[model samples]
Target: MTKKLRNAPAYIFLTIFAVFSVFPLYFMMVSATNTSQEVLGSKLLPGTNLLENFNNLVAQQDLGSALYHSAVNAILTTVLSLIFCSFAGYGFEIYHSKGKDRLMAVLLLAMMIPFAATMIPLFQLFAQNGLINSTAAVILPTISTPFLILLFRQASRNFPHEILEAARLDGLSEIAIFARIYLPTMRATYAAAAVITFMAAWNNFLWPKVILVDSAYQTMPMLISNFSSGYVTDYGALMLAVLIASLPAMVIFLVLQRAFAEGITGAIK
Candidate 1:
């Protein structure tokens, strides 16, 4: 009874914070269900115009194509990032060559440099390669992020060395050991990386906006930007689009949330 009383305040605080966090999303859904005029009127209750709002959004914007582009960017970037980042992380952890530590320190420092500084150079390189206004351009540069590499490296340190030595003694090649052993053991870390990479790629705006010149190649963030830039904005349509755009990220988070927690704990443990 005494312990429950002591913990009551913390639970109350958490409950309040959770409500505060969820209210905006709840209001967004309510606004999405209303007409533009109704949304502007500041009504808190849900209305019955969701279908109409969505239809208007579809009719006005190239939303379908934008969704396709976003999907491709997110999925491709996530998969490729996981592969290369994990490989680099594993190699850095296991190999330990001379000067490799210095190189890694430099890479970590590179992550601190603002991405805006590198944009012009990246654009020039992509343009030279005829990748301007292409989905490949969006996906290529994000394949090896420093942060994900760090995550994998931390997780790799916890990997069982006894198992690795056993595999080596059994005539397993390094690549085979990595594929059959390390990858499976780090499933939680990989799932966490997948969620993070997908969200970053999906919500990426500034780089995609600068690189993708053609409206046909625009992603969901670009579409939302177009909607909000107009003089007379359609709040209902905008809200609906936001709700739809957020769903994939939410779904990914929900699916991998448990693994994400496990991954973090496993790395630090």
Candidate 2:
């Protein structure tokens, strides 16, 4: 009884925190299912207007194209980043040199510069090249992230050099070894990278907003922003759009959750 009493405060704090964190998500889901009129009320329960809300949002503005563009940008960026960053990471770790190390240090330092500072130059360069208002603009800037390269470098340290030597002795080329051997061994790391890259690409707003001036090329996030704008807002439709927009990131995380956890553990260890 005394021990239980001692732990009561801790349990109470945890429970309260959990409720606070979960309530907003619960409210979003509930609101997404309610009518515009019903959403204005102070009800915590879900209503039977999910289809209606979705239809209303679709009717007012087409999210289908936005979703597709977002997917393309996110998937392409994730895949390319994994390839480039992983290759760079593996090279840096396996073939270290003082000059290369200094160059890498410079690149790491470059990451410290805020994106806002670089945005104007990036926009000017793209505009000069006639790439403004293109989805390529959204994707090109994110093709390789320095943080991901660092992640890959750290993870590559755990790889066995003996396996690499054995493959070389067997006359396997460097490209073959990396693709057939190194990549297979780093599944967890890649999974984690995929989750992070996909989430960032999916949720990226400022760069996309500034670069993509055409309404035709607007992404899901842009659509959500516009929904909240205009004199009157459709609360239920906006909530539904948010829920839909959030689904891809949530699904990607859930699918790769196990590997994601394992990757973090491996990186830490």
Candidate 3:
């Protein structure tokens, strides 16, 4: 009876979790399919207006342009971060100087300092350097986040030192070994970082809002923010826009599907 009761709890919690997780997705789809009026009336059943909502969303926003800006920025941020962070991680791990060790301590401290604390001073510095309202202002400030650096460093700890030593044995330069040998074997690491970086850049809100002043430069999040209004909020169209905005991150995770499992598997190994 006790063993049966233990099994009963697992089934109950799993059923509850599945419903909670799936309900939002179902509602989003239902909302997207209903007319704005039907949505306002709180209809839960899926309607026939999915395409219509999509059409309305396309006509309402410059979906192409907004997605393009988002894609470009996200790609840029991901690529630069992968290269720089991986290199920094490799350097800190491989070199092991006292100064670099101290810098790692500082990096940890920097992560503890809230972004809100630095926002005013960062804004002033960017303005003085003519970086405000520029893509650089958004992309550059975030390149060396402590979390990412530490993530890469942890992965580096698992790397086989013999490989690096062998490269040096063969007289290969450090940079060349990092580029050619280390990176190739560490594809899983890079793939894991890519998903996180892409999602971060895509959904980044506050700093982008501060720096990207032009309407053309606004992200999907900002677009969603302005979609709702005082008198007439088009819930169906808003849901459609959100669905579209969520696609890239979804697609990226789908592409790096293996990396999702890699972390868990690597941990056990």
Order of candidate numbers by TM-score, starting with the best: 1, 2, 3
RMSD of 1: 1.2
Number of the top candidate by TM-score? 1
* Candidate 2: tens digits of C-alpha lDDT, residues 184-211: 9999999999999999999999999999
TM-score of each: 0.97, 0.95, 0.91
In the range 1-269, model 3's lDDT, one tens digit per residue, is: 99999799899999999999988877887888999998889899989999888887777777787787788778899999989998988888877789998999999998889888988898889999998667788888887777777777777878899988998999999889998988887788788888888999998878888887787787788787767643777799998888888889989999897985684345235
TM-score of candidate 3 against the unseen true structure: 0.91
Clashing pairs in 3: none
| Native-referenced Cα lDDT, model 3 | 0.83
Which of the predicted structures, 1 or 3, would earn the higher TM-score when compared with the native?
A: 1
Candidate 2 off by > 4 Å = 1-8
Candidate 1: stretches off by over 4 Å: none
Q: How high is the CA lDDT of each candidate model?
A: 0.93, 0.91, 0.83
Count of backbone collisions in candidate 1: 0
